[model samples]
Target: MVLNVAVVGAGVVGLSTAVALQQRVKNVKVTLIADRFDEGTTSWGAGGLFRPDLDSYPAEHQSSFRQWISDSWKFYNALASSEHSQDCGLTFVAGTLLQNSPKDLGYSCISELTHDFQKLDEAQIKKMNLPSTFKYAYSCTTVITHVPTYLRWLMQKFRGNGGKVECRKVSRLSQLSDDFDLVINCCGLSAVELCQDKSMYPVMGHLVRVKAPWFKKFVFSDDLYIIPHNDYVLLGGIKDAGNWSRAPDPAKRNIILSRAYAMFPALKHAPILDEWVGLRPGREKVRLEVELIKGGNKKTIPVIHNYGHGGHGISLSWGCALHATRLVQELTSGLQARL
Candidate 1:
């Protein structure tokens, strides 16, 4: 008999989990349930950079966070080498971290740590024609994701593997428990209402996707960044914590564009393709755990949560999905052994 698994949410985390589970777990039926799909997800507008900000995880799960990130880097790195790299929305771009302080997580993590990461000095800054007072910089090779293409490819792969994606907005956990024996919740911000998690809130992000085929390098300036990819150059953004508004505010848009242009003046010439607004499914930290919830008539269902990715969903999706699959395996194996 095959184990039936339902993955809640259709964002990067959810879709990635479905793909990984189908590949790893044998004799399993996977159903991906979500109210919104494809472009409706916050992952659509992400810059998809690889370095993980340590804050992407809850404090209690810090160790696990490090492990997940390490595993994810390896996982995606292998995928990038494959012929399916484009389908996976993975590409290698030389990364530059420019900030005045040592507090920048990317600088700290990638610079002098990973492959070809080096700190830039005043001479190098001048050579790059960077801003004055930009007292710190680091250059390294890193991967960036094209979320739209990647999500579509992932969904296709999921369905091709005998998985089902149901388009529905779940009002209660009972609805899921009624159908599937196990549910993996990747509902992101919706998890706030679904799980009644008070710690979850929206970290708003505004991005401008412009056609900048001429631009290939990635630039990071404070919270604002200008990352160029194949389809469009991603200009981002602000981390407005506790903000629930999804509408793109003109003032915020100006701020984002201005900051990005200040870093790369040439971006002013790129035709504006679109402006995107998304609420990062932020929690005190990302939730990647399991729970047994009792529904009507004393029926218990296992739920594995993999949401609260904040702005790092694209960067951490593969890792989080891998972890969720492990939890699913544990759940199913325990039941099989009658443990």
Candidate 2:
């Protein structure tokens, strides 16, 4: 008998996990169950930059962070170069990150993986034509994810591989235990309710997508960023924790537009294509381990908890998914669950 596996989210992390399960696992029926999908998920509105927020992992797992990011880069980098890139919304973007004061640019894993990475000099910074407050900068070439396209591509890939999708909200883990032999919880912010994970928090992000075909390169300073896609440019945002509102705030829009206009005057005349507010699921540390929990039938069921990815969900997705796949492999070793 094949093991039934369920992944409980549709964001990048969830879809990535489901896809990895199909590609790497055996004798399993994978079903991606989520309340929302594609453009409705938070990952869709992300700037889609590949910078990994390394601190999101625990101290013990910190060493593995590099490998995770490296593996993820390899995954996206391949797609960005493939013929399906435009169809999948995968783009190789090079951009500058600036700050007013000198700070530790210690994400060596990202720097090491970038196709081109460097610190900008006075001339380089001058060429950017930024306000004088920005004194330090660096440039790097990395993959940016257009999650809407990527997620749809993943869904199609999953279905092609004989996977299924259930568009229903799982209020709790036990509810799924009856149908699935093992459940991989990639619930993201919903974990706060489903798993009673009090540590889960939401980092509200506000973004404005403008019609800027000329804005090919991205520029980021703190939470404020301008990232480009195939058709439009994304200007954002605020990173206010514990803010759960999804409606776009006019005040937040002004803050984003005003700063963007000052940084790139050309966009001042660019028509606003859209605005969005999405929550980045945040936790003190990412949780990626297995637990034997009480099931709906009172017998134990295997649960691989893989959520709490914060802003780096896309950056660390494949790495975390592969690792989660390994956990599923171990859980079903020799079909022990069948016995």
Candidate 3:
């Protein structure tokens, strides 16, 4: 018995959920329906660093932080070490977090889950070509997924596994109700209007892409982060909540470039590749739950809401996807037996 499942949105979270369900569930046909894909998505501009700031989530949501982070790490780290990692934009990177003051970043989840997690010594910090203003730093080895490359790879993998994709906007979940037995809503910020979820806000963000092949590591600060990808370096950014404009702000872009130069003087010589602006789905915590949409004739279409990950989308994608997959399995249990 084949269950028809439709996944809304095409970002990392959406694609991850689509792939997870296709691989985890039996006799399920997944059709990825989204308005955007690859570089067109907000996840495309993400730093792609697999680090989670669990403190960003509420206390109740923090309970699942460890499980999600741990599960995601295992998923990506395995791909990072695989033979075809380059094809999938998966790679391991060592990064340091610099702070002016010792503030708890809720590192408990990553601290216990990551392999090379520890505080850096003064000597090690001094060796970096960064400003001397940092008071403390934590060194950790984490996996990074170049979003654009990874998204394309995920699409390929999804299609390879008999999954389907449709490039279009979904006006309402009811539209999919007649066709799909289940719908997984990973529409990110659009969920506000799509699901009538007023709690979701848009966190406008800015990013600058630079050609800094000379740098091999990543750095993080209070408001700025520098992530080195294979061919370019991702520098960013500012989080302006409630701002929905997709256009890049020149003033903010200039300020970020200036700050990046101030942090690492060498970036001043590196050529700027591109600048981008997008919105993150801002919510108190990630929404990963199931809802029953009653349609005509008393038919119930189970919808699994998986969005509101904000800046942690790439980090929490697989973990939350796996959780959502469990819900799909649960909803289809009786149907599988009957069909």
lDDT of 3 by residue, 188-261 (tens): 99989999999999998888999989899888787888888999998986889999898988999988888888
Candidate maximizing lDDT: 3
Q: What TM-score fits each model?
A: 0.93, 0.95, 0.95
Q: List candidate 3 segments past 4 Å from native.
A: 103-105, 122-129, 337-339
lDDT of the structure predicted as candidate 2: 0.84
Per-residue lDDT over 35-141 for candidate 2, one digit per residue giving the tens place of the 0 to 100 score: 99878788877778887745446667777677778888888888899999998888988888787765443556777788688888888889877764688888888
Alpha-carbon RMSD, each predicted model: 2.1, 1.7, 1.6
Task: Give Cα-based local distance difference scores for all models.
Answer: 0.80, 0.84, 0.87
Off by over 4 Å in 2: 55-60, 103-105, 334-337
**Winner on lDDT (1 vs 3):** 3
Q: Write down the worst ten-residue block by lDDT for model 1.
A: 104-113
Which order, best to worst by lDDT? 3, 2, 1
Clashes of each: 0, 0, 0
